[model samples]
Target chain A: MQVFASLLAGLVFGLGLIVSGMANPAKVLGFLDLAGAWDPSLAFVMGGAIAVGAIAFFIARNRLVSLLGTPMQLPTSRAIDRRLVGGSLLFGIGWGIAGFCPGPGLVALGMGEVKALVFVVAMLAGMGLWVLFEARAGVSK
Target chain B: MTIAWSTFTPWSALAGGVLIGIAAGMFVLFNGRIAGISGILGGLLKPAKGDAAWRIAFIGGLLIAPLVYALMATLPMPQIDAGYGALILAGLLVGIGTSYGSGCTSGHGVCGLSRLSPRSLVATAMFMAAGFVTVFVIRHLINA
Candidate 1:
């Protein structure tokens, strides 16, 4: 049952990415291009995503337990520290340069674009680097 | 009104994002795990005792989702304009960033922030700002 829901959710996300034109790197690039032929369609996409999320969270808040089983786990950290800032900076720079974030990066791979493949490869490498560094420093994820 | 509604409608990206958020929330409820791509993928890379199953299942689900969608509807292929080198570089950067931050946008921004975590708020802001700056540099400065 949980697996089914997860599958359903993933499908909906993939479809949403497809239908909303988010799978297209050019469209995303257009949204990013504030000064040159700027297109705000991505904003609409982001806005729509937030609306659905708000309602969903509201409903989940009222539920005692999740559809799967346990109560929802929320992050307890309050420190606005370096890891947060540095990560965001890296993520944003990548998005700006490649026009593909993690979610869309996977979806882009489905499109069989060679560039997405490259991005995925590098993304995985970066993950590997982190693991190696963390292992050396005795930190766990 | 038209602009706002169109932007806010479920038919737009907001609806999809909301669904993603809800799914992440529900997954945590049932599985006690955050629906973060980086964490999920990372776990798969270095599996621990009794941790392999869920990670594989999660990634498998990701792959299977599109295949199922293709069977149901015509999946439009996305066009990527960046060169091979640029794409690879971007991916590597994101991977490192996810590790350094301990989460991705979905884990931090959507899931974490929704839970009102200050850490997520800052992370989300950084993600947006980084994206903003990256786009500016690429489109204006590098012209790539």
Candidate 2:
């Protein structure tokens, strides 16, 4: 039942990505191009998502377990360190260069975009490298 | 600077965002999991016992959604202006960064900010600033 819910959620999320124009690299690039022709549409997308998400999170905060009886597994980290900032900066640069974040990148690949396929493959490789580094550093995810 | 009013579709964007929000909300409420794509995909890389089913289901849903949309209307063709080299480099950076940072746009930007997480706020701001600077450099300075 939980797995079914997740599948349904992913389906809705992917549909949202397509409808919001997030699956299009050009549209994402337009939003990021503040110095050029900026499209504020994506801002509305974020706003709407946050508005609903805020309410849901509020409800989740008061609950000990999920509707399906699983423990609520929200992140508890609060420290703002170098890793967070540096990793975000690098991610942002990559986003600007490719105009493809993980969600949309995966969706694009599913749609048979060749470049997106390349991006997903490369991204997997990068993630593999992180696994190696984590092992060496004795860190667990 | 200037808003691309001609190309902007505020209503659809908002509606779509609502869908995303509801999806995320449902995921957490029912499954007790954050609907973060990168984290979900990363989990697949090193699958644990009894953890692979939902992740595979979620990804399968994402993959199938487009085909369903195609039955109703046309799917937008993604326009990628970057060359293959740049795309590969960008993908690598994003993968590594998200893993280290522990989130991406949907995770940090949407879910984290919604929960009023200080870490998410800082991460979002850093990534946004970095994105702006990178775009500025590439579009104006480097012309790449």
lDDT (tens digit, per residue) of candidate 2 on A52-106: 9888889998888999998999988888999899989989999999899999988
* Backbone clash count, each prediction separately: 13, 0
Give the local distance difference test score of model 2. Answer: 0.89
Question: What CAPRI class is candidate 2?
Answer: high
Task: Give the poorly placed runs of model 1, Cα more than 4 Å off.
Answer: A1-4, A58-65, A70-72, B1-11
Q: lDDT by residue for model 2 over B16-71, one digit each (tens)?
A: 89988988898889988788888899888887999999999898888887887898
| Predicted model with the maximum DockQ | 2
As for candidate 2, its clashing pairs are none
> What is the iRMS for every candidate structure?
3.8, 0.9
Candidate 2, residue A60: how far the Cα is off, in Å: 0.9
Share of native C-alpha contacts between chains A and B (below 8 angstroms) recovered by candidate 2: 0.80
